[model samples]
Target: MSPATCVFYGCRHPVERGMSKCSHHRNRAPCSALQCHNQAYARGRCVRHGARKKCPIPGCTSYRRASGLCLGHTATHSAQAKARHLNLPPSTQPNTTPPAATEAVDAEWVLGLEPMDFKLPPSPSWNALDSVDLAIIHILLQDTVA
Candidate 1:
């Protein structure tokens, strides 16, 4: 029998024995690797050409950050944003200096009181009494003069 031919348009290359198409015209799955033409592994690239998620920034090899940029790019963008917000050139911005320290005052003096000299009024003992006793007391007091 005549050799099987490639089904693709304008291609007359003979197919391999017991196969559908010639080596060049065969429906070989491509690797996930950029511009790679090797057969795929289960529709993905092989281990030698494993796919990886990279930062969106061009030529950056670092892993992606929350904003799709690498860590270094993210920091650069943040600094640019801060500079824009302050309406100043990043290079011309003043250095941050620590604030001056102030004297500390006693907590008691701040509240206008002398500790241990002031005493709170004693708590009422009625809260300790039973509900029945309170009811009896209320009835007795209501029946008596003011």
Candidate 2:
């Protein structure tokens, strides 16, 4: 009871219609490309766009999709490349997190030692601690025996 469908170009062969192809040339319509499902117009290429090339990155080859970088570098270099390619100001680039300071004070604090352990109370920056402190601490400990 239903109409027949056509299996030609731009055809929509519905099962109910029972048409071999769509409205287009059912017999003349060539097969779709292997790489793509679109109808093959020229050497497996549609009229609008052709088969895309692979990325030029070290080990990438999944369609030059975006920048010279591939899917792998898409997250890493895509944005950066775009910015640079557009000749944008360097200030616009994202800032990398600075490495944590490795000063001795930080390490000592982590160990949970007394404030004095880190030369607490902040030693006199201008004056260096000389032998005077040593002498005072060990003052006259030696005896002059007869």
Candidate 3:
């Protein structure tokens, strides 16, 4: 037999006939906590009855993610959320890590950290790239468009 929607008009949950709330509404179950009543949210209980998870950080009871950790706890997740808030793709977000020192101090760098879609031709100071190149790179990056 297929499950049906709850008989309670305000409630929108669906339930099987033999699940927790069969007495009041065979379609949807009520929370399973004894003598404490509210509609079941999931896992046979309501949020107040611990149907949902709490953030893993000690003493936190507010919001939580599926991993049961609080949001913004993960560095990558926080960065992604910031990118989303600013309407940018996570990939396009600016890199926070300082670029690793180049192995070729005197080598003329015509390419970017990634394979440059467009290479910069050799220039006077561009060779033996050091801190100054960062300003030039910043300018180039600011000017670049997809």
Q: Each candidate's TM vs. the true structure?
A: 0.29, 0.29, 0.30
Instruction: Give the runs in model 2 whose Cα sits over 4 Å from its true position.
Output: 1-4, 8-21, 24-38, 45-50, 66-69, 79-146
Worst 10 residues of 3 by lDDT: 103-112
Q: Which residue pairs in candidate 1 have backbone atoms (N, alpha carbon, C) closer than 3 angstroms, thus clashing?
A: none
Worst lDDT run of 10 residues, candidate 2, spans: 98-107
Model 3 earns a TM-score of: 0.30
Say which prediction, candidate 2 or candidate 3, comes out ahead on TM-score.
3
Which tens-of-lDDT digit does each residue in 16-36 have in candidate 1?
Answer: 777765788576555677765
Candidate 2 differs from the real structure by a C-alpha RMSD in angstroms, to one decimal, of 29.2
Angstrom error of the Cα, residue 80, model 2: value is 5.6
> Candidate 3 lDDT, tens digit per residue, 71-106?
545444544555665578757984543223432322
Candidate 3 colliding pairs, count: 0
The best candidate by TM-score is 3
Best by lDDT: 1
Question: lDDT tens string, model 2, 23-126?
Answer: 45443434455443346565556543554566777676466655564556665564465457557798986433321333233323334444443432433345
